[model samples]
Target chain A: MSKSILFGKTLAELNEICKQIGLPGFAGKQIAQWLYQKEVYSIAEMTNLSLKSRELLAQKYEVGLEAPIKVQVSADGTKKYLFQAKAGNFIETAMMPDNDRKTVCVSSQVGCKMGCLFCMTARQGFQSNLTAGEILNQYRSISEWAEITNLVYMGMGEPFDNIDEVLKSLEILTSDWGYALSPKRITVSTIGIIPGMKTFLEKSNCHLAVSMHTPFEEERKKLMPIEQVYSLEEVIEHIRAFDFGLQRRVSFEYIMFKGVNDTPRHVKELIRLLNGLRCRINLIRFHPIPDSPLQGSDDETIMEFKDTLNRKGIITTLRASRGQDIYAACGLLSTKELVKKQEKDY
Target chain B: MQSLNPVLITDSQPIANKAFLLQFNRTFIFKPGQIIGITTQKEIAPRLYSICSTPNDATVSILYTIKEDGVLTPQLSALKAGETIWITQPQGKFLFDGKPSWWIATGTGIAPFYSMFQSGQKPLKLIHGGRTQNDLYFHQEFQALTDYIKCCSQDSGNGIYAGRLTKYIDEQESLPPHINYYLCGSAEMVVDVRNLLIKKGAEYHQIITEIYF
Candidate 1:
């Protein structure tokens, strides 16, 4: 039997994996406890299984928990962990410790295909989609696994682009037979790929965060190329139509670029665009990447913009600049130094 | 996903090795660069393909290369004429505006440009990259354009450029910085070409890319 990683399988999938090798179906839950809750590094650590069953499983499967090959600690207590993908490409994950909530940002793909102009990941292009195991390993393999309170899919690649594995990881994370964490603590962010968003909304109860840089179509088109495919208007309309019950939240992420998106006019347009929506806007400070055509808005400008939006009754919050010294702009360190460029198909 | 409707295949012509032009009866209109999702079974999620046929054509055509391990394309290529397939209504914002621009593509990424060409919207130049001559899906049709260059890394002669598309562009003195550079290809191709173009003086806004996931 070919070896398969037993890290990120949902309860049903775990059941299937167990039954395929002639184990009792209930062993799936026991395995899930060891794999997710206990965060064991080896299948042998699953001591509840019979010695014979352990040998049977060890013949085919292993608890594949890969730790970060490299780590850079920011002065602000943000640690950027680098893990190698299955294809030998490197993916970055950031673990940020704030007050009481320790949020670990996970990447869904090795590199990203969505070429947002300001993103360093775009320059590296796309490498591959991470398996459900790869996504969860960023959370489980880290030393802070037990203390982590929230997980956000907001790192290297667009979460919605690799939706299946992302949803599977979510299922394993929240299933009572699995990690049994609250879905509200996990948020999946995207550049608003509608089909994936629709599927995610229908299937999962995780909070949704949309990266809406600008309200105007042409302006956004210049900022994020995804605007050309799924227009923000269509995305907003879709979000409006979907009923995200009170507990489920949808927030817009606006990365402030100096002269491009921060202005009185943009603030007004954003207000008009997001009117009547039970959502808030999160203004993020853009960290400048090498040869970037964009620069982050000055703090004074960002503060003024946030004030204007908040004064107008649109709740807006500015995200603190974390891990700047560590090049935490997701993909900066990996693409610049670590990525082993694979042979191109073309 | 948009609601899929059953459509009958009218013709399934093998254009190149492992590649085919599948034509189905057209019921609704679509823009030249728009894409439609297609699947052999209604219950399965349809894979998206650019509409390769012009709007006025009675039948809608899509050019696809068969991926041996792909869930949809293998079954799709094996499908014959008179077989029914499920397809979504044409929806995509990669719309063509008949602007004078450079169209860069590789493999079956040339589908959208072919539709635009068939629709009478000519590009200033069409630069297509393919590993082999067989990889160029519609080089013969594109020959009608004022400027059509085939960058074939494997295939030679026949007036084709003797290298990859990125190399061909690199050999040039300078690519025009003002005109639009529309690229449709794999993510690697798009990123590499876009970076090269930017390095060669073309501004970011002058470039538009549609990358396949």
Candidate 2:
């Protein structure tokens, strides 16, 4: 059997491994440097370690990074890269370049269990939860690894649903022993799983973006099933309780559905629900998927809605759609056809 | 963290293979199709279970199966009648509006539908899917319904459709397009049924789903 990969291990996990392997305690830091700081692809690349130690490490561990197997570049410079996840399942990552900022959208799970009505990923029906290694490998194995300035956990699955792996990936991305990226440059998006959201708020300093497509409870339940379990009222209350200082940010992602959620009533409710919260509203244009009944709100209606929110003291910005040609836009990332078939429990 | 309230198990019995119907004394009123968060201890994060009993019942019941690797279910299945368990107040918006609708479910996903049925709301049809004849819980209660259809994938018996539920839906000459369709199951089952319903001419709005995450 192949040994576990060392690339995704936190400093403490590496320390545990070092102790088990009978190496000096400080070797954990050295291994971390090679696996993360240097981004080495092999255990033998640690020339400072003794040959015996290197051989021992190689016997049980590999760097565990797999490069993207396919890439589809959009006409507008957005690139969608596909990587093989566990058990022959596939995941897509999008790299969008805009002037100086390069943002990479990474998936947290193989597919989504959250069956949001507007989501294409939900159609795939959740294959497996990606390990922290698989999650980080999407960032590390990409071609724009060096220049990528922003990371969003908004690709395929609900990041908070896989909270442990998502938190570990965040730690690896921001810790000094890992990639050491700023938490400000990272944003984790959730459809509002309360327990996971609370745990995330208490543990990480990264920005959070909630998928709040509508403000009304009934409408939101039709659009996103999570609203049924963790109501929008509860989610907002939790956010209100958390003290996100000036540096850390919180944002709501609203996908405008033509006739459903684009009306003035929704804007008023949005303002009322988020009255005292210090946050921004990211107004996203809905990207229609196959067999979807909903259509995106017209540009004029979206602009008007944004203006109403801005007038109400909420800092609302209209997010430009990207990678639509390659289906890398929001709610469009899915690998349904590539999922391995198994006898479903249902 | 949401505070949990202590409740005593009033009854616990196996309803099907690896599935159990657990009843606890009701402490709060709830809609027919609401869920409660359950845990063995105060400190542990609770898992949500759909209330399987009607609101009028003296005790609330929940249906669940033992997931071999789950943190809660194995312990939940081992509990006796007098033992204590912690649960949150009833919550969730998957309520069935007494409208003429089709209620579809699989395995323990039948909990919410059963709650609605026991609450005196009769669906236009109840299509239940299970792997075997033994997997169909509460079949006797549903057998009286005029449109109760049972689909067993692996086992075929009298009056049971000998295939997947989706197959039975696919073979339908024409599905009622006007009535609402409520689906509850794992993600795969819900997604598959929703897509099939849409393909068979049902509008997206007509199909409401509650997936087990």
Candidate 3:
């Protein structure tokens, strides 16, 4: 049986898997091609491998894409799919359809670790990183399969902390023999993880968007706990090293809060902090969730804030809020549905 | 879990060593810069990719770059035309509003602003930057949008400005006052340009930036 090396298996792990299956040593790359490139659903589809090799693979490992157990459609075209994972825990993925494109939002972890004060997924805490297959299935199990045009890793967790698995999934998504998307189409957002940011910059050609809701370091910590460990200052410092000067883009996600981070002082400070960096600020209207300490800024305030940034010469715009009525907007997603199912099981 | 029907790969190709352009027919409307989800015929679903082409285009277009040791790209490469795949609808806030203006971008960051130029909304100037001449995608299309299409090549020798876009704009003795700077590309470039334009006394209301990375 080929051992299940779907997690963070380095090249050495692949070599051992190949040796046990009695294939030539170089076949490890071929295995990688299948796992990361071809992204086949089963060993049967590994036609390039010998029958004996395929048999050995089938004995131990199973390709990871699992189907969602249930699907819920929002009034708007957003559809959320729920799936039960290896340990019986569940996660959800969202599919949103617009005129020219189909966008699927996928989860990286069963739950999230970054306890941003307003996020429900963060309230669930971290479960575990998803296997490459499980992560891949979010794309595989949906309608209008042939019409998808873009991908954003903005669903459930902090992709950077789950770096290895996320990187592998990204490899499969962009590999020449795999999903083969131009890196520009795929954007992975993080709450400022230094190590992961560096790795992503060095490795992936895909775009990067940082979750920088507040330019002020101290105020930012109130909304996102990770601000303590990896300061926005450090995140910017690391990003500045790489030249996004060309096609590569760096954007800061600024969620506007009514009386909190949306003041003229706040906007001016945002301009001051980002004075030297070449980046854009996405002024996201704070999505209201139950018991959140913050309230969303009024449209007027958002516009004024955007005006200040634009006036100051930092390109800024208000991000349109979507899926709010369905608890599907930013920071509004909850696994309470799964929690209810678990209570039923009990 | 039910097995998904095969993904219909409408078209796929490697535009660069790690980037790809995957096209498919959309039964729905998609606005430019909206990120949509995709499920391959093999049953693997990845996150949303931003739409590059204008919604008016018949076929949907996605421009993506390869991730190092990433999984999605390899799978995307194996696809051929006519294979089944899953795509979500368009989603995002980065697009041209009714206000007419100039468009600026760095590298592949030019994708979102692609529609802005295609529409020919108003008098426009597209200033794009890349490390080399070949890195510039959609150059001719941008040139068609404005007579002042400035290409800033940082590494390769085929441009007037050898360094950054900010440097080139800084040297602009007389940019029109009403010109709205629609900037896209890397965060660093966006930040630098914003700071410089403001320092040079450009009004913040006249500048709009869509962060690419």
Q: Which candidate's DockQ is highest?
A: 2
Instruction: Give candidate 1 misplaced runs (Cα > 4 Å).
Output: A338-341
* Cα displacement (Å) at residue B189, model 3: 40
In the range A211-238, model 2's lDDT, one tens digit per residue, is 9999998788777878879998999988
Query: If you assessed candidate 2 against the hidden native complex, which CAPRI class would it receive?
Result: medium
lDDT per residue as tens, model 1, B1-213: 779999999999888888899999999988898888899998777878888899999999999989886788888888899999999888776766666699999987899889989898888889999988788887888889889999988778998898899999999997765699888988668878887887788877778877666
Worst 10 residues of 1 chain A by lDDT: A337-346
Candidate 2's residue-wise lDDT over B57-163, tens digit each? 99999999998978899999999999999999888989888778999999988999888888888898999999987788888899878999999999786999989
Of the true contacts between chains A and B, what fraction does model 3 have?
0.00
Superposed model 3: Cα runs more than 4 Å off: A1-16, A24-40, A330-334, A340-346, B1-213
Please give each candidate's TM-score.
Answer: 0.96, 0.95, 0.56
Cα lDDT tens digits for candidate 1, A224-307: 777867899999999999999999999999999989899999999999999999999999999887776678999999999999
DockQ of all predictions against the true structure, Cα-based: 0.53, 0.64, 0.01
- C-alpha positional error of residue B77 in candidate 3 after TM-score superposition, expressed in Å: 46
- Candidate 2 lDDT at A187 equals 97
Supply the TM-score of chain A against the true chain A for every candidate structure. 0.97, 0.98, 0.86
lDDT of each: 0.87, 0.88, 0.67
